[model samples]
Target: MASANVVDNSDHSRFDLLVDDKPAGLVAYSRRGDNIELVHTEVDPAYEGHGYGSLLARSALDAARAEGLRVWPLCPFIQSFLKQHPEYLDLVPQTQVTRFKLA
Candidate 1:
C-alpha cells in the first residue's frame, strides 16, 4: 500500500496531499468569514487516477467541519465531489445550496 497523508497548509491556503512523503496533489481554498471557498484542485499528472483528488477534497472538507465552517465549492472538482458525497452536504450553507445545487 502507498503511504499517503493530507496536511492543511494554512499559510498557503491549501490542503496538500503527500504520497510517500512527496507532493501528490493540492486543494486550494480561501477563507471567507465562516465559510471556506474551494478555489481549485490539482493533482500531478503522475499521480492521476490514484484517488488523490478525492483524498484532498475529503481532507479539506473534514477540516472545515472541524473548524465549524461552511463550504463554497468554487472548484469544479470539489463541486463534483460534493455531488457524489452527500454526507458533506451539510457543510454548504443553506443560502448557497441552490446556487451550488447541493440540495
Candidate 2:
C-alpha cells in the first residue's frame, strides 16, 4: 500500500494529498472569517479510484476542526461528503446547516 499524506498549502488556498510523495489530489478552499468555504475537490485522473478524494476531504475537514473554524461546503463534492459523514456536522455553522441541508 502506498503511503498517503495531506498538506495544507495556505499560500494557494488548498489542501494537497500526496500519495507516496506524489501529487494525487487537492481540496480548494477559501477562508471566510471563522469559516472555511470548500470550493472544489479534484483528483488526478491517474490517481482516481484509490480513495484519494475522500482522503482530501477528510484532511481538509480535520484541519478546520484543529483550527476551530466552521465549514461552508460550497462544492457539490463537499456537500455530498458532509451528508454522508455526519460526524463532522458540528463543524458546520448552525445558521448555514439548513442551507446545506445537513440539519
Candidate 3:
C-alpha cells in the first residue's frame, strides 16, 4: 500500500522527491526540539520549474504537521512557497512570522 506519510531520509537529513523510485529533488532541514528549520530545497536542473519543488515543500510541511512539529522556513524557496500557499502559514508560529519574513 502507498503510505500516506512521506519518508524521512535521515541519513541525508532531507526528504526525497522520487520519480520512478529515484530522487528528483530534496527538501533539507535541521531539527530543532519539536520544530524543523527548512534549510534548503532543490530540484535537479532538469526538474526545475516542474512543480517538483512544490512537491518537496508540501511533503515536508505535511510531515511536520503529522509529527506535531512547528516549522521555521529559512530557505528562500520554502519561504516563497509558504507565501504562495497560506494554508501552511499556521505551521509557523504566529510570533515568528516577521522574523522569517513570512508575514
Candidate topping lDDT: 1
RMSD vs true structure, all candidates: 0.9, 1.1, 3.3
Q: How close to the true structure is residue 23 of candidate 3, measured as C-alpha lDDT?
A: 64
Worst 10 residues of 1 by lDDT: 94-103
TM-score of 1: 0.95
lDDT of 1 by residue, 1-103 (tens): 8898999999999999999999999999999899899999999999899899999999999999999999999998998999899999899987777887875
lDDT on C-alpha atoms for all candidate structures: 0.92, 0.91, 0.83
Q: After best superposition, candidate 3 residue 19: deviation in angstroms?
A: 0.9
lDDT of 1 at 40: 100
Per-model TM-score versus the true fold: 0.95, 0.93, 0.87
Candidate 1 vs candidate 2: the lDDT winner is: 1
lDDT value, residue 36 of candidate 3: 94
Q: Which lDDT tens digits does candidate 3 get at residues 4-100?
A: 2246897888998776676677888998799998999988886676677888899999999989999988899999988899899999988668876
Per-prediction count of colliding residue pairs?
0, 0, 0
Question: What's the distance in Å from true for residue 67, model 2?
Answer: 0.5
Those runs of model 2 whose alpha carbons end farther than 4 Å from true positions after fitting are none
Model 1 residue 53 CA deviation in Å: 0.6
